[model samples]
Target: MDNLQRIDYLLHTNALDEMGKNELISILLDEYGSKIVRLAYIYVKDQGKAEDIAQEVFLKCYEKLDQYRQEASIETWLSKIAINICRDYLRSGWFKYFARGVIDTFPYLKHKETPELKLIEQMENEKLMQAVFSLPQKYREVIILHYYMEYSTKQIGDLLAIKSVSVRSRLARAREKLQKKLETGEGS
Candidate 1:
């Protein structure tokens, strides 16, 4: 069976010892840790906070494994948890006070034929990310999931508990806003 199917079987069997459970959790972390962290980073905009949120996502997964419905892929389920945790973090007073002073960008490592080309690409990416970040939460999230995560509108709608039409609308609005922001060099 595939890894996801295997995970489903193990979760449903009620046959895991502590060691088995840890192994399962480890497998899950290995599979989805970076994905969860990246999703959280799009929301919270800090690598450290994103990593913490990923840990929380896995802890929640372990605690609630029995509640998994198998209606979606494990990655989708983990993403939902990470998004919820990031939302909570974003809404916290602590985040408001401390996060304001922190300007952490995702480290991008790439090899280019020329240093000038690398600098140009990096600056463009940073501008795009800044534009995305300046969007309202609703628009930003749809943009992130649709473009960054490469999820379909239907999948994004399912994850966000919204209509696919809503996802499309948000995506269009977000693109428009991003285009405007990029052209104007706003929020850079």
Candidate 2:
């Protein structure tokens, strides 16, 4: 059987032995590593730390696989796990390590392109992302979920365990913060 079939079987039968579990994890990591790592990096802003966080997320998923109820798509469940892991990591004060000198060390800021338009677009996108990242955690989480992950307010509220009104408030605050950053050419 193909990998997806194996994973589906393991999940449905709830009979995944250690080896089956390991194989499932291997398949997920192979398929989703880059996307998970990128999302973590966007949250934490450090490549190394992001990779570590992604690995931790997968570990958590493996440990909790038996609890998954298939209420949502597997990808959504995994993303919810990843986002929670990132939020917990942010709450742990580790982000300070990444925040230090990040502006100076930002790789995207150093890029050069021969095409002036493309370069401008890249710079603008980088600036916007930086601004988003600089928002307060409450605002940042909503914005990232809404924009980066394309989650609706209701979905975000459900994932974050907040009311939809709270999500809307946070999203509004985030947009206000982003606008201020763009207008003032300042992050944070």
Q: Which 10 residues in a row give candidate 2 its minimum summed lDDT? A: 111-120
- CA displacement after TM-score superposition, residue 57 of candidate 2 (Å): 1.1
Query: Compared with the true structure, what per-residue lDDT tens digits does model 2 show for residues 1-188?
Result: 87677667777877789998898899888867777876776676656777898899899889998888898766667777888888888777545565554645875643433243253356458678667767888898888778766788988887778899999988887888789998999873
Poorly placed runs, candidate 1 (over 4 Å): 12-20, 102-124
Q: Which structure among the candidates has the greatest lDDT?
A: 1
Put down candidate 1 lDDT per residue, 1-188, tens digits, no spaces: 76667777777788877777787788898878888877886686556667889999999988887687879887888888888888888889987875554433313322213433344356458688778878999999998898878899988988899999999999999999999999999968
Worst-scoring 10-residue span by lDDT in model 1? 103-112
> Cα lDDT for residue 98, model 1?
57
Residue pairs of candidate 2 with colliding backbone atoms: none
The TM-score that candidate 2 achieves is: 0.74
Give the per-residue Cα lDDT of candidate 1 at 52: 89
Residue 102 CA error for candidate 2 (Å)?
8.5
